[model samples]
Target: FMDNSKNMDIDYKKARTFLDAGLTYPTGLGLGLKIKVNGNYAVNLKFNGKADLNAIMNNPRNAHFAFQFVPSGSLELASTLAVDADVVESGVKVSANLHSSTGTDLTVKVLDGYGVDVKLGLPVKKQEILNFHSDVFSVIREKTGSEVETPVKFNVKREDHGGCFDQLNTLTGLTVCGEVSVPLDGFKVLSPAYGPSKASLRIEKEDESLTAYHFRAFYDNKQPDKLSLEVLLDTPNSKTDRKFLLTAKGSMKPQKQLLIVMESPLTVPTTFEAVVIDTELEQAIAAKLTSDTAAYFIKIGAHISGDINRRKYEPILEYKFPETAALSDKGWIGRKGVKGGRQQQQSAVGISGAIYVEKNPGTAYRQYELQSVTLNTPNIKVTVDGTITIDANLIATDLKASYEKDTLTLNSKIQKLGERKYIARVDILPSKYP
Candidate 1:
């Protein structure tokens, strides 16, 4: 009596029903109840009430009652302080935090019947989780707890069939100020017209090198076609991304070809190879034609002779005839004409001859010594030596010059003669136009 009262024995049973007998053959209302009790167990009676036979069962939209009994007296209601962990199902693994009563975070030890603790953040009161069956997504924490993932997104758009397949290629040579765009995909590249889209890439340089290889692929649903990019690296070891700026503009046409014009500084030497082109480069070179209207003509060769300086006489050189014609005008031929005029005209208007500078024989003479002279006008021949002075109205025919003792001489036909001091003659032909 001092210790304990028998545990209240309790038990209960109940039933309720509603029915209609259209023929009035039978009308029914029923209720059932019962009760039982014992030291450790008990049962109780219940009441009958009207029941709706058409009431919906198992309403998933509304809350449902559930109960669970953990037999282990120590029903660890989760570790008092546990970190929330991820719950992965299908192809998607959601990682978030679960906390303990003490606010200590918890981690998932095993998930989906698999080993691997998926850590979690704080639990959300109302959470919506999206799980993709065809695609896979996973989250893993780093040692330093940082997120390191290259995010991928895909989007697609629609276009007219004609706008989809048109393609083009081109070759461009750029100096310091031009660029080209080479298409990498078919025109109507997006499929499902709205399905996942991706940009594929191929990069190259005019001269292949590691610094030349660069590209990126991305999908923009606002754009109907897959995009491509080629970026040139300035340095072989450039570490920064997007150091160069790029923009592209083009059209799918009633305009036949796809033309992509680019403008950029010649930051580096580069070349682009393409399959087609719709536009001509303004600075492009035109091919040379063999059938040109005008051509360049060049004349080059040589004329042979000996040194005029070595002649025996300081010859008086004359060109052309009649003293009116000049050797400079007719060159070598003019000099011949002057000689011919002397022989034929006999008037001695034209003349050319050579005079030798002579010194006193065996005496090392210091002044003018005449060597010899020949004239076509009168066929005059004269042997000269010493300081002999002669006077004649000399029309010098052809005078050629040479140096002896540094003295100058002239040999020619005589129209008149004078003393050795000087010779004065009329119709004396002079040298060419100097």
Candidate 2:
């Protein structure tokens, strides 16, 4: 048996030989193996009678995307039914629940090996459950006793590496209540390249308090040089005093640097901190080296600053003015992005400065709020060699904006707010070049 797997090192690289005496040998050489990839779909072929077969997927090459149509008067109700069956040597657990605006309290557990621990539904003040029971390999639950033997059904969707890891983590979370130790043998067996995946999901509810936490870890083999170990934790509930945090920590072997992100629901967070270890500093001084034929000179300096607490970036630019012998007027252009309405958000040109900072900042204030920007100075004659862009909302009244060579078109709109009141909104929507 030979592996036509993607791993180049493990691929059989031997030759089949048939010779004198007992030298006759079976096919030993691995040949005619190629992997065809198109977008997310991949197929591996080894050109042999015995080959791994997989399901085929449909492609919508000529189909246009559209939303699924739902009738106006029709109503769709979905339920969650999880049936876990166990063989004679193994045990399984089945669970089912119906969701409401509040939450779901129904669950079914089936134990075949040790003993049966059946829970139809946890008694809630107002919630009701039918009945639940499990046989050797099936669990039935419904509103009456006649449905005991009738197996429950539900659909499950999954990704290649996404859903299985979630299931494993949930199992681990159920077993780990307090300080629990895990041995190497307890982990599922995996190849060295694609090994080491663990996850845990935990939830606790009591009276008006509820808490949920999910932990996931998996190997990320995308970055060849950097061994990427994805570690993530999300706890959205604030029932505990420890503060709510959604953490996506990078857990890798080198441990050179780990960006453990602790993000709340809002930007401009209340507080933040960082501890630097094995810092590597890099500095460069840019100097102007004038060409022998050149007569004019220019100098520039740049500085970068960031605020972790607010997650804000402020860039400041100061430059040494070059010789202005023939230059008269000089002006600077600035662009500032404010909150926008639906029109602004869906406009051709998007000018969002910090949309990620706030928790879904209102679209009303997310528009262009430009008081003014200087396009020309008193002495300098500004003739931009290339095309220049300026938002009509930010342009000063006196500044004239016209293209030099290209017929720059503007997508402008005028709206009236009230009687004898109007506002001009203009933007250069990007489209195919003329």
Give the root-mean-square deviation of each candidate in angstroms.
Answer: 40.2, 30.9
lDDT of each: 0.25, 0.26
Could you give candidate 2's per-residue lDDT for residues 286-401 as a string of tens digits? 22212222222121221222332212221122122244222113222111245321122121212222111111233322222212211233443222212222332232122222
Q: Each model's TM-score, in the order given?
A: 0.12, 0.16
Model 1 accuracy (lDDT, Cα): 0.25
What is the TM-score (0 to 1) of candidate 2? 0.16
Q: Candidate 1, residues 172-240: lDDT per residue as tens digits?
A: 111111221222246633221222222211122222221221222222234443233432223223232
lDDT of 2 at 172: 22
